[model samples]
Target: MTLSLYNTMTRTTSEFKPLVEGKVGIYLCGATVQGAPHIGHIRSGVNFDILRRWLTHLGYDVTFIRNVTDIDDKILHKAVHENIPWWEVAMKYEKAFAWAYETLNVQSPTYEPRATGHITQMVELMQTLIDNGSAYAPGNGDVYLDVRALKSYLTLSNQKLDDLQSTGDSEDSFKKDPRDFALWKAAKPGDPSWPTPWGAGRPGWHLECSAMAHAYLGAEFDIHGGGLDLIFPHHENEIAQSESAGWGFAKVWMHNAWVTTSGEKMSKSLGNSLLVSEIVKKVRPIELRWYLGSAHYRSMVEFSFEALEENSINFRRIEGFLIRASEILQRTPDISISEKFAAAMNDDLAVPTALADISDLVREGNSAITAGDNQSLGTIAAQVRGALYILGCDPFDSVFASGAGSNSSAMDGLVSLALAQREAARARKDFAAADAIRDQILELGIIIEDTPAGPRWTLAR
Candidate 1:
């Protein structure tokens, strides 16, 4: 089936046709590098990673760009609060976000451009906007986009220019219209400054993305993506500035829904944010990724420890099934993704549907285990691994292999010692002692099942 995606610009789901027949270019708005990442921030990364993987799986040569805003006002503010250089502050959290992405198994983008490194591109684009009469310098070394002058100003956001509020990135007095936003902010005292034709200053938040996208993906690209929160002023401004400069910036726009807590958007100000590092301690990284990507990309995920633990336990069941199947087969099985899973993925990355298909495979695999049907079990195991591989949750995949099973060598030894004691008590006809030991292991969330091969242990559901 041909891939289809929901375009935020058109507000519809349609077939995806890349500008180049077999090549796809995607530009994703990446982190601002002001603070450590929370699950809210990483959700976008995981959702897009699935998109990239599916596209690649379909034989498309995908060039993905995820940019970093290293010179943002937030970064400078954080530097002040931490008593460090602004660049140091940016680097610190940039590393933190990188670690978080890696831990969650998010594939690295083909190119990750930093705002500071692309000053020349931003300057050139601003000059193009000025020459095209779509921007003004205002004699203060600051450049502002002429919001009222553009014939297609708010089309992406589906808003009327007259009804809009002030852009807020610059002083209203600096703009021809209060609604106009900053293309360049004039340098202030003790702030980082880069030389530009309009004197010394830094690029605005919106300009960094347009400049980098054009520099890397040319005048037009396949898809531009970010959180739904960016649908407003940020992405809208990108369209205004880039189109005014005579470039078809992005053919399609995609925005993933927010991760919310108590029906409120997750943010530091809300005091309900869960950092990736801390959350990983409570559950495995792969389980966290699965939970984050479980919902459709366009749906909100309500954050709750209860829900997260439930999903993680469900994932362990699937992982446990795959492990048992592997042991029965006595060798690694070949991967073969089912058509139903692919069709669901093709339909606008319908992850929940694809996951449901995975659950069905698990159920069938379990039944095969019950019937001792090794031939059928092997095929089902391969299909399960293939689906999990697409979702980045394959238990045996190198990224998650280290933490694949609960029964590691140390854990196995301890459980086995306890089981040995129970066996000894049973041999001596001490039924009470055997039952007590069994109860203790059960309290540790381990279940021991006796088979003709001997007693076997597994983590309790």
Candidate 2:
């Protein structure tokens, strides 16, 4: 089957035909970089990362651009509140985003653009709009896009021009219509401002993306993506600005649903919004990725601590199968993975279904091992690894690749200390001391089975 994607632009699923024959261009809207990224951010990144991997698997060179909005109101507010510089705030959160992405196994974007660094390109685009009579600047140095000028201003949003609600201070008097959003905001005292044609000012929230996307990806791109929450005002305004600027804008618009807590929207008001760091401390990282990736891309993901604990448990079963399979490989290894899972992945990147098939293969591999069929077991294990790797859920990967896992160095040191105590007791003919060491190891949430084969260890169940 040809790769088919549900395009929000067309409101339908269609076979994906790239602009270039063997290449894909994807632009995903990244975060504002004001805070540590939560699961809401992870949902979009993981959902699209799987898609990018699938496209690459099918022999498409994907140039994915996920931009960072570093110069937004939130970043400014955070800088003033924390008594830190605005750039410092952006850098701190950007680092946090990178840390979260690595732990969650979300594949990095091909080009990660920061909005602040692209001011020249933004100014040039605003100049183009001004020359084209689609935008104007007031006496106060504030620039606004004239909504009445564009023929297709509201086409992407599907909202009537007049029937729109917006919040701004100079909105009512400056705008010919309330729906006409800002292209640029004039500089305020002590605010981070760039020198522009409209005096010293900063680009608006919506205009920054338009400028960045056009500057890097040209007037048009193959795929544009982000959270469903950005569908209104943000992305819609991007389309208007680009399309009105005489560029084709984006061909396809893809959005991933939010991660909610307890069937309610995760918000500061609800006091239930959990950070990625807090959640990762409680659960394994890859298991958290699995929970976010279980549902279809457009479906809302309900998250909770209890759900994550179950996901972590389920992941262990897969990991245990991999550990056993690895031993089978060590003995006699001539295994080739099946491409049937690839076929499923090509069907719009159906990860959950592919994962289910991998589980079935694990079951088959286990039964075959029981029947002394090592060859079949190794082959199935190879295929399972291939599928899981594409899904970013490789079970063989160390759970604590980063410091995010429950397996801390402190805990490991304690385990080794207990083991050393046991050895010391054995040397001194102190069986009681050795037994006490063994008990101490158990108390630290580790199982130590002293087999005749040698000492063996695993995390406690």
Q: Output the TM-score of candidate 2.
A: 0.87
lDDT agreement of model 1 with the native: 0.90
> Cα lDDT of all candidates, in order?
0.90, 0.80
Report, for all candidates in order, the number of backbone clashes.
0, 0
Residue 191 lDDT (model 2): 97
Angstrom error at residue 388, model 2: 1.3
Residue pairs with backbone atoms closer than 3 Å in model 1 (clashes):
none
Best by TM-score: 1
Give the per-residue lDDT of model 1 (tens digit) for 1-461: 79999998898999999999999999999999998999999999999998998899899999999999999888888888889999999999999999999999999999999999999999999999999899999989899999888888777788887787645665468788888889999999989999888889999999999999998999999999999999888999999889999998899999999999999999988888899999999898999998998889899999999999999988988888888887778877678889989999999999899888989999999999889999999989998988888887777877775654535899899989998998899899998999998888899888887764567788764
Off by over 4 Å in 2: 166-171, 331-340, 397-444, 447-457
How far does residue 137 in candidate 1 sit from its true spot (Å)?
0.6
Candidate 2: worst-modelled 10 consecutive residues by lDDT: 397-406
Candidate 2's residue-wise lDDT over 1-461, tens digit each? 67888887777788889888999889999988988888888788999998998788778999999999899888899999999999999999999998998898888888899999888988888899999988888767788888788887566557776677556556458677667778888899999899986789898988889988887788888999998878887888898788778998889888888888778777655667688898887777887887887667888878877887787777777766765666545642333335667666666666767777877988998887677687788788777777766777775555445421336688768777778778788889999988888887788767776644346456764
